[model samples]
Target: MSLTLRIILLIGSLISFYLCVKKIKQAKLKVENSITWMMGSFVLILMSIFDQAVQWLANKLGFMASVNFVFFIIIVFLLIQVFIDNIRLSTLNEKIKNLNHYIALKENSDEREKNVKE
Candidate 1:
């Protein structure tokens, strides 16, 4: 609600957005992964620039403090990010397991052919 806080949030969000872009340029982060960061920074900037929307939403949501609503949004976003990461990790693990199994089977068949030739 305070002007100082708003300025800080705006500056922080801008810095975050800039850094996210830099990472993308450097090929250190994929565009898909950076989407959440970009969106988060954009949301912070939006809430900072449009404080009235935050207040109205907080009122509608029955949150006495707008700050509480902000924190809730941040926590929920982070939780969703964590869930998505878990799903990605699970898929990667499954792919790795399948690859390893295929390699093992291939090696065994190759060994059998070699033995038959010998």
Candidate 2:
């Protein structure tokens, strides 16, 4: 491999390792999941460098010279999923805030009515 490819792989591996460690430390990811992520990252890095591997399969399966196509498609799909999840979370948050505000308003109105009656 060329020096540049070696450097890229090293950097990618380090980044993947760092992410796995961070996730584990934060309790956001289980050990198994972290390991999977780390392994996936390594594979992705390897695929990035040895693009011919993807091409060979693609050709065997009747895909064109667009080995990078699969990678980009996966990236776009993940990004869309992330965006959709973020939107859903934001909507739920807004609903919760509105419910809280409505409850507070109702409680205050009830108190006012009780005081007036007294």
Q: Which candidate is the best by TM-score?
A: 1
The digit string of per-residue lDDT tens for model 1 on 1-118 reads 7889889989998999999999999999999999999999999999999999999999999998998888888899899999999999999999999999999999999999999999
Report the C-alpha lDDT of model 2 over 1-118, residue by residue, as the tens digit: 3446546756876797888899899999889746655765666677666766666766776765544455564577568657866997999999999999999999999999999999
Could you tell me the lDDT of residue 44 within candidate 1? 92
Question: Roughly what TM-score does model 1 have, to 2 decimal places?
Answer: 0.92
lDDT score of residue 95 within candidate 2: 100
TM-score of every model versus the real structure: 0.92, 0.52
Highest-lDDT candidate: 1
> What local distance difference test score does each model get?
0.95, 0.71
